[model samples]
Target: MEHVGVEQFPPDKTGDAMTTALLHLENHYWTESEYLAIGETPERIELFDGSLVVTPTPTVGHQYIVSRLVVSLYEVARSAGLHAFAGLGIRLGPGHIRIPDFLITTELNFDDRVNDSDVVKLICEVISPSNASTDTVQKMRHYADAGIPWYLLIDPRSETFHLFRLDGDRYTEHAKAAPGELLELTEPVVATIDPAELLPPR
Candidate 1:
């Protein structure tokens, strides 16, 4: 199937390109090939089965938290010969893709823009208001279904963090921390995290 690239639809400052992309995508079942064809978009787009989940650009605060978390994770991951990345696509299945806010993986190279779920060791998502349930509920199920061993959820609004470890086919809460507490972990790379450090200073 021939898929159109983003260059075919010029974007204006008002987001006409995204609108054009969505209009063209409506009523169509997307495959990985077709989804990848629309590369380098300004918006974050994930595919579930044949559906497209379009997420608006993240706020500056969200990016700030993600950046800080990635740096912290990277220190431990690199020491253990693993790589930590932010906003990288992971292919959970044939038509399933998700871009976690941060990921730690054994795969050292990512020239293809997407990697298989098997290469992933842990997936972390910092909650955003617009997709709270999607992050806390839907993605929890999806990551478990993909056999991702560890899932970490950080909620900046709540100033909390929850870490889950896969047991059998589902994830069980392994550790969590609230404000003024520390979230420490041993497996999947050891690290101690203070939720307060993730937020911007006053």
Candidate 2:
């Protein structure tokens, strides 16, 4: 699984020191029920490389970008007969996971997000400067590993949105589309979009 640096909190004895039985989970596979059952502590629990990472609250700029990305993504995807969800967790590996900003599935028969099933056609991340590593590195690796056919990243700092095409277990750089450029995706679904409209004007 790809790893963005894990978020660590100040050590506290109140955590109960509950060590997980992570027996040889190196290839990044996990069940949904097992994932939610772990680490119920108030701290943000993110699954990383077979462990739980306590993440921090994202910054305001990060949130602004996320909100704008959501609106744009929803508009484009829905018009094209796709389904998308925000803040949904996906199993990437044994202990590796991701809760993409938006998850879009184009398969007509795979419309199970409101119920069950883990596979998705595409995953998107709204990137902030703080999440450079995760968006570029960690997510790129895991999304590819998970066989998610399309990956889109919205980077406010770059003033760009990236659309990746999955090739086997890795991604090929499909386009680093400028705000107004439309990216045409060829995958389990087909989507034409301009990411520039996804962000507030610069």
Candidate 3:
């Protein structure tokens, strides 16, 4: 996911973390507007089916993989006259908001508050340890429901990557690879990624 910079959370100041935890425990349902009004939160949060889902802060490993993938994908998208952004909030439908790890877009509006999935050619998510199911299963369904043409999932712990394409109302797996394998994709965007490079330093 995209971040301004690494935020150092000192142990003494745990208010934000505690509040986020409490909110999760309450299982509150939030509207898309409400979630958007909350700006610059201490926690990584998203709105799924009108429910607020809080995710743990990404680890260094996750950042490393996302950075490399973004760079690689950006090169391809830029050459194709498209823009690639990290951590942009996407509106999949009413009450459905997603912050994809990376998104390739054709729109140039910098002030766009919420980008509709129609212009999004590709969406990617680097699975975090705490929210594996959200990314792997829940988000996969959401993106499909939004009619996104392409979706990619990278798992740091498993050292695996998956690419999916929208088929009607569902997604069909197009390609998958483990570390040391090359995954080539075409259609919405064209690029090759070596899953091995996505692995964090040992």
TM-score between candidate 3 and the true structure: 0.81
Instruction: Put down candidate 3 lDDT per residue, 18-103, tens digits, no spaces.
Output: 11123523445566655665556767676766666666778888878888878877878888888888888788888877788888
lDDT of each: 0.83, 0.63, 0.76
Q: Model 1 off-target regions past 4 Å?
A: 1-20
| lDDT at 109, model 2 | 47
TM-score of 2: 0.66
The digit string of per-residue lDDT tens for model 2 on 98-142 reads: 667777765434332222224588788877565679788977887
Lowest-scoring 10 consecutive residues by lDDT in candidate 2? 108-117
The parts of candidate 2 lying over 4 Å away from their true place are: 1-35, 38-44, 75-81, 106-118, 186-191
Candidate 1 lDDT (Cα, whole model)? Answer: 0.83
How many residue pairs clash in all the candidates, one count each? 0, 6, 0
Global lDDT of model 3 = 0.76
Q: Give the best candidate by lDDT.
A: 1
In order of appearance, the predictions have TM-scores of 0.87, 0.66, 0.81
- Which pairs clash in the backbone of model 2? 28-93, 28-94, 29-93, 29-94, 50-95, 179-196
lDDT of 2 at 168: 82
On TM-score, the leading prediction is: 1
